[model samples]
Target: MDAAARDAQGGLEWRVTVPEGATVKVEHEHGAVARAWAWLLACMVMVRSTVAGFAKRVWKIAVDDPRKAVHGLKVGLALALVSVVFYTRPLYDGVGGAAAIWAIMTVVVVFEYTVGGSVYKCFNRAVATASAGVLALGVHWVASKTGELEPVILSGSLFLLAAAATFSRFIPTVKARFDYGVTIFILTYSLVAVSGYRVDELAALAQQRLSTIAIGIFICLAVCVLICPVWAGQELHLLTTRNMEKLAAAVEGCVEDYFAEEPARPAQVKSDGYKCVLNSKASEDAQANLARWEPAHGQFGFRHPYSHYAKIGAAMRGCAYCVEALNSCVGAEVQAPEHVKRLLCDVCTRVGTQCARVLREASSSVATMVSSKTLDFAVADMNTAVHELQGEMRTLPSMLTVKLAETTSLMDTMPLFTVASLLVEISARIDGVIDAADALATLANFKQVDNDDDDKKRETEMKVHPLNESDTDDEASPENQITKV
Candidate 1:
């Protein structure tokens, strides 16, 4: 049934219509043999796709983080062991069925990338669980002893325990690392104590929970440490090295973007150059902390000199600050005078390239845990480049001063002045970075010092500059900031 009507604007509108007898028909007309062949072909196609999809997904997961596969395997094995022990009559009767659940949770909580972190967490969790179980048993016994004080004893004990645990979390030292353990302790205590009120087997329940958690922790520790273990320190060192490379790349990119005669490309902004350096600070800090928790092994000893890691981090921040300033000077909003642009281009070609190259060397050197003499040469070249940039910047003020003297109004010269100021600031920041690099080199024992006073003086000068607060921190000292190269 089709119909036409006049629209509001006085135009005829045709409406979609289906005939009364019209039907959507999907008919299969293949003969018996042909239909069987079609069905077989469709099944083959579906099977092939399913298999391919499964294989592709497996590859993707493995490629993303091969360690993830290892972790998964470890978890599975730990859980399986718990299940096997739980199903066996003797073991299951000895500990209680609930022991298996606690064992599973232990495996979930104790696994960490570094053996040190895992062990540390395992110990903390095991101790916390044991302590909580004991306390819950004591609370249950005390409540049972009281004739009419069961509710009061249980509720009041919970309130006190909850308040104390919550207060401990607010303590700065505990909150950073052990907060999770504290939270689990509180939860386990509450569950055990509260649930024990109805169940007559409070002691048995507590014992089972503690035993299961202990077993799980032991399994995780053994598997993580003895197997293909990954060290957080190694990861941290690698991250630091990568960040160095990223920092160098960022500097070069920012220099190119700022001075290029052509318009900035969309792809340029999205590249790893700027974003990598910009987002590195917090990630690097966290990784370093995790690394610190890792036990000394391989190249690292009990007295592993990880303090140098802090120095390298600070140096990266110094480099990052300069790079960020350079990044800010990009885009159509800012423009420099023709002569100033030429000067910048020349500086970038000479100094910026050297910075990136040196940083790349430093990154490699750090990863290898070896000091390179090349950093000294890089520092020398960087010094020359900095001086050259300083000379170019000095000319700007002279030129601007002349213009200001000749013309009463400073408006025309202000934009160029701002550009010159940024260049000068950039030079100043590079000066700090150079000093930081030297400091880093010295701390890594790569650079021998007859007298530390000279390095100290240079660092003092860097600290005076107000380009950023990174240089003012105690760790911003020359020794606290370093790179391998």
Candidate 2:
């Protein structure tokens, strides 16, 4: 059987079915004119959607971040300038339309939001374009001398160059900054070489290409620097500070709620806490990489503290790990005795306060480029909080033994002491964060205060911080330590 279906738009599609040992006869036909019109209509629909999408995005950007509007304006002005220069009387006649397009493309390609980024791209494109032009000229000269062999030589050369350019993207350093340049290099080289074969004036074509590329690079750099420039470094600084604040909030929320009497939390709050931590890690890492291309401006010198920023990010992840463990222990699977709970609450309070202070101070320092010596005081407070928590932790085993002794069924009560052991592990991770923060402060060039010798003994206390309660529980089950207690 043969069947045809008509779409809502009156387009028809045919289907045919055949049984075993039977031949199915079907007709599938559309006039060339009708098919062409249908394709045109489809193209029109796609064009409409594309324009609508572009307009919607532009409106969204204008509303969300007005500073980005300057980028659009800059691009429009540069494009206008390119059109004027290339379409004008003397220049248009001098450099033909074919040659002018590469110059215009350079304007669209090289311009970037940051002055440093634009400048870097400008120089890279210029070098790649000029080298490609020269190499293309040499290849054209070789092919011309070969006469009938020209096609073979040119085709082989293009194949080799294209393969090489494609493979170059896999190189780590090239993939980072120059991958786009390599692609553009292959394109420019092919265009020049192929066009040179057809055009009588190859030298003039090469000269015009190099000149046009230079014009584009110069104009993009000038506009990026002279206009309302958005420095990548400044953006990175703000993002890093904001990420710190977000991390601080998440940590505080997790720690505070975990130690609360009612451990039950709204699902949204828990989800948001972990989401913020995870999102900040991804955002901070990307921004750090982009910031590497930024030049020194304002407070930063030629060499910025990218390494310190990375270390801070790593420390934040460590803090998030501890928070996750705390969250895991928050349920009825773990419980703290009244006295130990109070001590844990006190530690959480101190840790929260010091963390907030450190975040504020760090953010302020990043913004103002003024080193805060008070971070030394904050770190010291965190260290003390960690030490006091460790002291409480030392007493936990004995207290748990006593508590276990009172219970008739040790197996039923074992989960409660897991909270105590988890608290010890959390304290050690917190101490690590404090140490990392101190190191980060040093890297930030903060004025160092005299180290308090008293904390040196407290550092040794951290060694006992990891109390693997699982092993303890297992050993207790086998040896009947609960019975001994």
Candidate 3:
């Protein structure tokens, strides 16, 4: 016989009594309720962790750029202003629920973070909507006149207009500025053409949509321009200036790391700092395009030669490429001998430092909106450093011939040669950057520094007080030293 009984621990146990008084007991497994509780606990933990992580990311974003938070609020304000149309009786009657939906949709689509971006999209949407509506009305009139071929006429018009608009998107100039407009044109045209077939009040429908969308666009533009406006022109100017500084820092860092007694570790190499310049082309182009839509704001005037920034960025990237190659030399496995590096160390460092100084001065000129006379001086110093480097290079063969004496392989010297050559090329590229910056200054009417008087006074002082040997030595530091070998 088998019987069920509760054990001392209060768990269910099954006991079987056999002949000769032998007994066996089986413990009960846990019930489904316990498993359900465990699963529920796991789900709670996962949900809690997911929520915490999402909140952390949101907080980080909001903190990193408070402008993003402000932009969000501006968007909300625009939406709220447009939503009043639905609540007011007159507006509700004029713009029906169906049309009011378009107003809301327009606000959502047209409101951008930057004032220029919002203006660009709003203008595009309005013009595209108006143009498409008028064209649709004309096509509808023609289709109605032809009774038998009405459907054919409508379909043909749709095909031709849609094809033309889509093809226009492939054009570079059109795609950059008017791509959004073309897309909206196609959507508005298709809606009116297809719906006009079934509905008699096509003109009223188109008018309601156009008027409401215009209202939405007006509200969006007002909010974007008035509420803590972020100007694309200013952003682009700052970005270009910041990139120049980064280029300078990258050049300095690369040279420093390369000539360090120990080879740069992977971590040091990874943080080369030139990556920002390499990846900034897209952002620069986008900002330049949007900036053209903005009116005069802050230091940037109307039609403020924003295109010159693209040229400057291109020149910076060219220099950045050389810096990247120089960085690679820092980690090369086959290094030049200690003596070979020592031979060119002072000249290389001097040239690199001067290149960085030139970049920094150019960047400062751009940032301050001043045509810096000091920038000319910096360029002159850079040129002198380059001459000194060339002089060192001329003596390098003879010096290496004596020191190496068939002891060093070609592979061992290649890294040093690459670093030296890149530094020289980088110095050449700095001239392009300087030229672009100068052009921008000229076009933008940057404030010119009057330093002739200061220069003459300094020259007079220098002529009166001659430098002693100690003073000459102090002035002829490693950076100012002209090395022959």
- Any idea what lDDT model 2 has? 0.64
RMSD of each: 10.2, 14.1, 6.2
lDDT string for model 3 (245-363, tens) is 88898898888888889767765633366788899999999999999999888888878999999999999999889988888888777788877788778778878887888999999
User: Model 2: how far is 349 from its true place, Å?
Assistant: 2.9
Q: Give the clashing residue pairs of candidate 1, or none.
A: 311-480, 311-481, 440-482
TM-score-sorted candidate list, best first? 3, 1, 2
lDDT of 2 by residue, 1-485 (tens): 22333654356465456566655432223356678899999999999999999999989989998878888899888888888766687876666656777678889988877665686677678878888878877888889888899878888888899899889999987876786679778988888756734435877777877877877777777777778888776776676666567655665665566567765565536324535655566666555655676676766667677656666666666766766665665555446554445644665555554555566566666666555544555455455555665676577566557765564343433443454445455445545545655565566565433556435423433333232323231222212333333
> Looking at model 2, which ten-residue stretch has the lowest summed lDDT?
470-479
Query: What Cα-based lDDT does every candidate model obtain?
Result: 0.65, 0.64, 0.83
**Over 4 Å off, model 1:** 1-61, 113-117, 142-146, 197-200, 269-272, 303-311, 337-340, 396-485
Specify the highest-TM-score model's number. 3
Cα lDDT, model 2, residue 481 = 32
Candidate 1 at residue 106, lDDT?
78
The residue ranges of model 3 lying beyond 4 angstroms of the native Cα positions read 1-43, 197-200, 269-271, 402-411, 451-453, 457-485
- Kindly give the stretch of ten consecutive residues in candidate 3 with the minimal lDDT sum: 476-485
Which pairs clash (backbone N, Cα, C closer than 3 Å) in model 3?
none
